[model samples]
Target: MAKTLLIGANSTIAQALQENSDREFICLARSEGNLNLDGDLSELDDVTDINGLVYFPGTINLKPFTMLKEDDFLNDFKVNVLGAAKVVKKVINQLKESEGASVVFISSVAANIGLPFHASIGASKSALEGMARSLAAEYTNAKVCFNVVAPSLTDTSLSTNLLKTDRLVEASKERNPMKEIGDPQKVAKTIDFLLDAHKNWMTGQVIHVDGGMNNLK
Candidate 1:
C-alpha cells in the first residue's frame, strides 16, 4: 500500500479520508501533539518516500473587510497558505522518491467566487491555489502531481458556527445550485481520486468539489 502523509489529520475531511482510504497514513496535527505548522518540521524529516500528501490545515476567517486586521490576514495566510507550503517543502523530496506521487491541498469556492466577509480566507485560498498550480507545473515532468479541492460551506466541525441553526443551514443550502452544503466524505472521495497512483496525469488544476457553488450559482 502507498504511504500517505495527512496534515491537520483531526479535521473532518481528513477523518473521512482515514475512515475510507486504503493507503497507509501518517497523521500530523496539533491535537495529537504531532504537528504545529508554524513550528519546526524536523520531526517529519525522517518520514520519507511518501506517495501522497494531503494538507488539511486551513483558516475560516470570514470577517467583514473592514473588521479584518492586518494580523487576521497574516494569520490566515500562515494557516491556509504558508502552513501547506512548509509541509510540502519539507516532504518534496520524499514525494519525489515514490512513483506517481500526489499532493492535495484543500481550497475554497471563496477563492474563485466573490463571497462577502470571506476576505481573509478567500485571499489565502487563492494564494494556495496559485502555489499549487506553480508547483504542479514544476513537478509535472517529475511525475509528482499536485492538485487542489475547493469546497464551499461544508458540514464539518470547522463550519459549526456557520451552520449552527436550521435556518442558517437551509439558507446556505439555498444559495448553492445543488441546494446542499458540501459533504466531507464526498470531498474526501474527490481527494482520493486525485491521489490515485494511476490517475496522476492531471496536474495544475483546481477541482471544485463544492455543490455547484463555484459555477452555476
Candidate 2:
C-alpha cells in the first residue's frame, strides 16, 4: 500500500481527493487535525517511504496592487510557499525512499496568466512554480518527480468571496472559454493522475486544470 501525505487535509479539494483515492493518506492540518505543520511534524517520525505528497493550503487575497500591504504578500507567501516548503523538507527523505515518488503542489492560474487584483497570490504561486522546477532538476537522480497543478477559480471555500453573488459567478464564468468554474473533483483527478506511478516519465511541468482560462481567449 503506497502511503501519501496530504497537508491542509480539510480543504475541499483534499476532501474530494480523500473520497476518491484508494491509497493510504496521512492527513495533516492545523488545530484539531491529524498533524500541524505550523508547529512541528514529529508525528511523521513513524512515517517512512512516502509515495506521494500534495500540499493543499492556499490563500485568496484579491485586491488591487496599490491597496495591498506588505503583510498581505507575506501572509500569502507563508501559507502558499513556506508551508509547503516546510512539509516537503520534513518528508523529502521519506519520499526519496519510495520506488517512484511524486510531489504535487497546487498553484493558481494567476501565476502564469496576468489577471487584475491577483498581485500577491500570483507572485507567491509564481515562486512555487519556480521552486518546483528547480527541485525537479535537483532530484532528477532520486527517482522522484515534482510537478504543479494550476487551477483557475474553483468553487472551493477559499474562493467563496470571489463567487459569492450570482452576478459575480456569471461574470467569472463568462471570462473562461469553457464558460464554467473549475470543479474540485476534476482538479483532484488531475492531481491523482500526476501522482500515479504511471506518470513517472512526467516532471517539472505545470498541468493547468483551469477551464481553458490560462490559454484560451
Candidate 3:
C-alpha cells in the first residue's frame, strides 16, 4: 500500500494524526524535511505512489481588513492555497496511479463565518476550500478523492497568541455554540476518516470539525 504524505507535518494536528493513526505516513515539513515550499517539488519525486496527501500548512494572520495589505493576502495564499496546489501537482501522477487515493486540506471556520481580525486567513482558507472542491471534481473519474477539514480556534502552538490569557480563551470558547474550543486529536480523526478511501464516499465536501461555529447562532 502507498503511504500517505503529510506536508507541514510538524503542526499540532498533523502530529496528532501521526500518533493516533495506524497507517504509516511520509512526513515532510519545513523544519524536518528541509522543505522549500516556494522552491521545487523534486524532493517527493522518489515516491512511487501516494494514496493520501494532507496539507497542514497554514497561516494565522488575524488582522482587521483595513490593516491587511496585499502582501499579507499573498503570503497567506502562498502557504494555505498555492503551496497545497504545488504539492498536489507534484504528486499528481502518483496520486492518480495509486488506487483509492485521497487528498485533504485544512481550513478554518472563519472561512465560512465572518470573524473580526480574520480577513486574511479567512480569504486564504476560503480559497483553499474552493480549490479542494474543484480538485475533487477534476479527479472524480481518476478515483482520487479530495476533501477539506475546517475547524475553529484550537489550543495549539499556532494559536498561542490568541489563547494566551484565560480571558481570551474563555471569550473564544463563548463565541462557539458548543462553548468549547477544538481538539487536535478530534480533528485528526476526521482527517483520518477522509484518508480511508474504502470507507469514505464523500468528496468535494468541507467537514466542519468546529464547535458548531460555522452554522450555530
State model 2's lDDT: 0.88
- Any idea what lDDT model 3 has? 0.90
For each candidate in turn, the TM-score is 0.97, 0.95, 0.97
**Each candidate: what lDDT?**
0.89, 0.88, 0.90
TM-score of 2: 0.95
Residue 101 CA error for candidate 2 (Å)? 0.2
lDDT of 3 at 165: 93
Q: Over the full model, what C-alpha lDDT does candidate 1 score relative to the true structure?
A: 0.89
- Each prediction's RMSD to truth: 1.1, 1.4, 1.0
Model 1 residue 165 distance off true place after TM-score fit, in angstroms: 0.6
**lDDT tens digits, residues 105-217, model 3?**
99999899888899899989999999999999999898899999999998788999989999999998888899998889999999999997534787899999988888888
lDDT of 1 by residue, 73-157 (tens): 9999999999998998899888887867899999999999999999889999999999999999898777788899999889998
Q: Which segments of model 3 are wrong by more than 4 Å?
A: none
Ranking by lDDT: 3, 1, 2
The 10-residue segment with the lowest total lDDT in model 1:
196-205
